[model samples]
Target: MFQNLSERLEGALKVIKGKHKITEINVAEAVKDVRKALVEADVNYKIAKEITERIKEKALGQKILIAVEPYQLMIKIVEDELAQLMGGQKADLMLTGSPAVVLMAGLQGSGKTTFSAKLANQIKRQGRQVLLVACDVYRPAAIEQLKTLALQIGVDVYSEPENNNPVAIAQNAIQYAKANHKNVVIVDTAGRLAVDEEMMNEIEKIKKAINPCEILFVVDSMTGQDAVNTAKAFNERLDFTGVVLTKLDGDTRGGAALSIRAVVEKPIKFIGTSEKIDGIDVFHPDRMARRILNMGDVVGLVEKAQQAFDEKEAERLNKKLRQNQFDFNDFLSQIQQIKKMGNIKDLMSMVPGMSKMMKDVDIPEDAFKSTEAIIFSMTPKERENPQLLISGNGSGSRRKRIALGSGTSIQEVNALVKQFEEMRKVIKKINAMQNTGKKLGKIFGR
Candidate 1:
């Protein structure tokens, strides 16, 4: 997402590379480049200058370690400052009261409605009964849109289609939650094209009426500095508890994420990483800073994996692998689990050093479509027994049928069968080695 900024920052750090000491001349040169990078990434000029000045001071005043290179020290300093510029740590939502109320606010087209559903889905996954309150009475079909999303996420939505008062809708929704035993009520309020008194007043009244435990101001990160300014206005009026940056997966310069907390004095609670309902992630400043500097977020990647992979299913797959029973059905299930982890490119970028390596690589979202299609075309027997599709007397006809069903060439089917056979062999070898290891451990007792 911050590819250009990351590349520029890397180039900037190279200014002091190979230098034994952090000299003022080299530090100034590096700091200048860093400032330029930040500015080019749509960060405010004054904020960029201030942060770069701190970096410069830290570089000059620090005592260099024997093992740490000058470039490495500078990277650490920049990463720390960037994290500080954003929130120093992750901010969590306060879900208090019998039914905690969360008020959503933002300008029109800021993804306020969509993020409401995403948040509800996340809270529902956390074992809470969530009620999505659609208070956008002015916009046509806004309530219906929320209803559709709520249905997709399997959450209840409260809306008064005929009622124009958002404050009343919110108040009634809270009552509904109490009566229905819902523990969380997320009120999605309306937004205008620009910040205005009417929109501000309505949201403020709703906030007062509902007394939300958290007021999240959602903004489009692609809006750059404008998102920061809009957040400032909302914070001044409604005094939001936190910020939510949406559309972060777009071709954004990342200025809003870096500047909003410094400007509005609020923590960024969550970021919308993709369009999927499960695309939301708790904003972690240190991880994001590392990512911006091209040092990938291993912790975040692991968290994604933990969320996507089901424990019971994982145990099942492990048993299959250990028994050398890994088949196409199991392989397809694994692919689906990985797809649930969000965008392929985004997931890969989380690996250490992969972001820089994939800077120019275009990994499409549907990169696995062909593989999935080919697998789906196989019969249950064929999927369970890989040998059924291999090159043989009867296997040729089976492969041809699969190729026709999957809309792929015969050569593609043959290649997939060959790859699957190789994979099965590898699994068998691994299982054999594991068995041998266990036997040796039992035999060589002290």
Candidate 2:
């Protein structure tokens, strides 16, 4: 995420904190800081300058409005500018044809194959039959990887490994999809390490051969400016209809995401986070702008939660929490839900103030592994009633066996069980306090 850019912009706005109004001098300092922050974030210098200029003009024009505080106004200004810079509106994939042929283009390792499977899963979720076509003839393993992903996601993959010509393979894949009544065909083409004439020519030929409805250029956001340059090169050759920004879960400076649209004039249709099939999110400029301002993207967060939420399971867990009966089982279940939500770093960064407050901290991706180990070590009954193990020191012979079973040391299991017991006690106390406070509030209201 753009954690660095977010922090810097927050600092820049602080320069005009508590001001009752916007002045040219104050706005100039803040805008300069914003430009500098963007530049430091690896954003194109020209794009950064152009954005700040637009922001300043908007702020100055709105100076007469006294409704919002200076800081609030500044945030609003930045949000609008950011949204405008990214794209004022989200773009949709052109899926008009009976088999909406999507052509994927990028340099090698830009995540084309993974994105095709993800998109297939997405369209399948929409109740459309999707056929993931493997046109990466150059890499023998790519088709296999795509097939595995398709199977995991419950989507069909069309591959002709014996065919060396990608254009022919793509054409055959579409024919197979049509024959099978599949309505969506995602054609994954081969990519070179860099934009080569041969690769470009092949992709362009495949595009013409398939007559695709959408040609999506996949770019690795981790590559920053290089990603933007690659998009430009690809767009010049392929004239892609949309962009898929992959590896956005990484600590990308966000330069590519910021500059690609301005450079290539294409809407970013999707963003890829982890390798998981469910890790793709449709790009939204407004939500992204909100995130960049350290404001919690409640819309995006709820969408993520809804996607991750299991209604029956959440209701069961809520009952346990309300009854002060939450245990290691519930904790483990929650961890699974969180894992399904995609990269922990990217997820946490969406929470307002979490990324900033935890800047110096490191939360490993294997965050739940230790806890999972401890929980697995517990007996079925112990997981349900953790108090016994907690009160028994979790050091008995049975406890040691449980720990060994879960592949964790006895001490770590003990710590986990102890924390769970302590948490239950804390919840009970908080509930009692809240009940008493509610009574007092009612009396005061009366």
Model 2 global lDDT (CA atoms, 0 to 1): 0.85
What's the lDDT for all of these models? 0.91, 0.85
Instruction: List the lowest-lDDT window of 10 residues for candidate 1.
Output: 192-201
The segments of candidate 1 whose C-alpha lies over 4 angstroms from its true place after superposition are: 193-195
Question: What is the TM-score of each predicted model, taking all chains together?
Answer: 0.97, 0.89
lDDT of 2 by residue, 1-446 (tens): 78888889999999889998889999999999999999988899999999999989988888556677877898888998898889888998879797888888888888999888889988888899888888887776988898899889898888777888988888888889888999999888887644477777777789889999999999889989988888887888778899999988778889888888998899999999787778899999888888888886767877888888799999998778778898878888988998888777777778877767767778887888878877777778888887667665544776788778888888877777677778889988987898899999999999
Q: Pick the candidate with the highest lDDT.
A: 1
Best by TM-score: 1
Clash number for every model?
Answer: 0, 0
